[model samples]
Target: YKSIIKTIKDTPLEEFYTSGHRTCQGCESALVMRFLAKAAGQRTIVIGATGCMYVANTTYYSTSWIVPWVHTQLGGSGAAALGTAAALRALMRKGKIKQEPINVIAFCGDLGCADMGLSGVSNAMTYDYNLLIVLYDNESSANTDIQETSMTPYGAQTSFSRPGKQRRIMKKRWKKSVVPMIIAGHRNIRYAATMTPAYPLDSINKIKKALAIGGPTFIHSLDPCPKGWDYDPRFSHELGVLAAETGLWPLYEYTDGEIAYNEPTKSIVEGRMKRKPVKEYLEKQGRFSHFTEEDIEHIQRMVDEMYEEWEIPGVMPIKSL
Candidate 1:
């Protein structure tokens, strides 16, 4: 843990994804990409899906990616990355290329990973390719006017699920747990973890560790979107910290069939760190401003259930309402 912390603290002051891109202010996806670029270095190829990152970064007559980047269909990112990795391995084996090993990474949004690109991502995990799939989940289809995706939290207002006189409700279903779905589906995945851009050091360490582990790995990063969530751009990092502290977005990693909770989350579960109220986390964002007392109670109940499921014996007792 100390070595990993040191690696993040000692990261070179180099910007692999330089400024001047058209990403919105406080775009956490862009931050995730920047960290990934720094961790993977120059010997990497980024396979991007048809989402905000691809559209905003590679606009007409310009690009923000300094490393080799390929834009693929929304549902084709995983397949393209798998093919690239396979081709690289083939060329190296046949002595056609004498270059060092190149990392192939696919970056996609929540809609791409959980909705349109689910099959491709599942197949990639099954194939156990030497690649990394980074899912920057901002909760909505931000590129398409903030439509509600499967990963969108319940009671949050989105384009598809808005409050109206006739409906008077937001999203009805719970947010999809893609992390557990992937872990359950793929038995051979080398690494799978949940992270947030707010935790820069942890995020960087996870990316570096994923790249080092030579097998299919998945990093689900909770990227806060100011436009999508209707929050002030400045509160992005604060919201991320709140999300984890409230147990709404727990940080944990699965490696070699072992599950381990990371800091804050570990402390929260152990009762060493007090879990904050879910309302404190939600009240800051406009997306949940319409939530009534009943709505907050429901959300809090869900959080409690999650805590119960993740409780660790011999540590500390789980916090209660």
Candidate 2:
């Protein structure tokens, strides 16, 4: 692990997604795209869905992407990427193109992934397309004025979940676990993992691994949105770390029917590191500012239940026993 980290750190800086993009300050999705592009290298084709990424990176005629990129519909990027991969395979088989292997990557936001594009993504996984699907989950429909997405946490205020004087009704639904949904639906998926930019090394490693695996790879990255979540822009990384440490977003990898909990998650499972309070995570963002003491306790219970559902004996347990 040290060697791998050293190599990644020592690697010469190469930017596939260059500067001059129109992303806001402390944009986690932008950071995730940059990291993924760096790991994927230049011999890659990116299919971006209609969301913050598409609007920010490709304004009118100008684009920040240096490699081949295509814009797909909000709910069509997954299928589009699969089609691109199939075309490439056909071309290679016909000896029409003699260049090195090119990777097809689909980039989508939480709205596109869990809500609008769920069927497309599930179908792509079912077909076992040789491509990478990256879901940059910011937990809300950020580009659409911070509307509540399917991945939005409960007790969070959004455009769709406005607080009322009579009864403040935040999001009532819990964030959907797309990872388990994919795993349960597609048995042939070569690789899947949850990552965050807070751990750059881990994120890079997972991207590299997914690219190497070559068949229906999925990576769910927690993207902290300062605008949507209403947090200090500079605290993006801090928020990510807090989310992981508090078990609000536990990092783990699933491959070949085996799951491996990573870092603080593993430590928490083994009783080496105590799971931090979920309130520490929720209180930091304005989205959850409306959460009461009872709401906090309910969220804490939900997190505990989530951990238990994802537990794997000797790898990740229900609690620090």
Predicted model with the maximum lDDT: 1
Candidate 1 Cα misplacement greater than 4 A, ranges: 1-8, 310-321
Q: What tens-digit string does per-residue lDDT give for candidate 2 at 1-321?
A: 222344556644999998989988999899898988888888999999999999999998899999999999999977898899999988988989985679999999999988999899988887755899999999888997998888988878888898777666567887888777787678999789999999887888888888888798999999999999999999999999998899888888898888888887888777788789999998999988877899999989877776655455322324444
Q: What's the lDDT for residue 179 in model 2?
A: 79
Total clashing pairs in model 1: 0
Give per-residue CA lDDT, model 1, range 76-182, as digits (tens).
87898889999998899999998687889998999998889989998888885689999999999999899999999997999898888777576888887777788
Residue runs of model 2 more than 4 Å from their true location after superposition: 1-8, 308-321
Error of 2 at 204 (Å): 0.8
The C-alpha RMSD in Å for every predicted model, in order, reads: 3.2, 2.7
Candidate 2 local distance difference test against the native: 0.86
lDDT of each: 0.86, 0.86
The per-residue C-alpha lDDT of model 2 at residue 15 equals: 92
Tell me the TM-score of each prediction against the true structure.
0.94, 0.94
